[model samples]
Target: MAAAFLPPSLITVIWGFIGIVCPLFAKGPNKGIIQCCLMLTAACCWLFWLCCYMTQMNPLIGPNLSRHSILIIAKEWGNEITNTTTT
Candidate 1:
């Protein structure tokens, strides 16, 4: 199955350009170092962004709401609180 998403693809392309393309145009004495730094930085930043995005898409934990708080929220939102259980 293929999941079509624009943000992730767009971000990857932008980072790919920065890491792979930008390095080729480096000049001066520290050209190699500059290229290495650019590639490494881009990879780290892209990985971090991807991780955060994936985490948000599928959160590890759900909200833990107390019965009282749930009731309050339900009443405020005009939603009926059917059952309240204590753990």
Candidate 2:
């Protein structure tokens, strides 16, 4: 349960830190564009993760959502593809 939240949350924190630190080290004429792009990317990453988290928590959408279930499904799909293809 907790493990499911770690990846996206950690990524959001990392991006937030980058967004803050990038502007401080910015130099030259392209500095403004660089800072703006970094900040925009960070914002998008945060928002996307937030939406994912919210959807996972929503009872109406997925009452018993689990990261393990998703992983299992992905693993099964991979196995199916691997078995279908011959080398």
| The candidate that achieves the highest TM-score relative to the unseen native structure | 1
- Candidate 2 similarity to native, TM-score: 0.53
* Global Cα RMSD, each model: 4.8, 10.4
| Cα RMSD for predicted model 1 | 4.8
TM-score of every candidate:
0.69, 0.53
lDDT of 2 by residue, 1-87 (tens): 898778777887798898898778888899899889888987887888788877766656535758667667778787422324448
Whole-model lDDT values for every prediction: 0.93, 0.77
lDDT of 1 by residue, 35-62 (tens): 9999999999999999999999889999
* Candidate No. with top lDDT: 1
Model 2 deviation from native, Cα RMSD in Å: 10.4
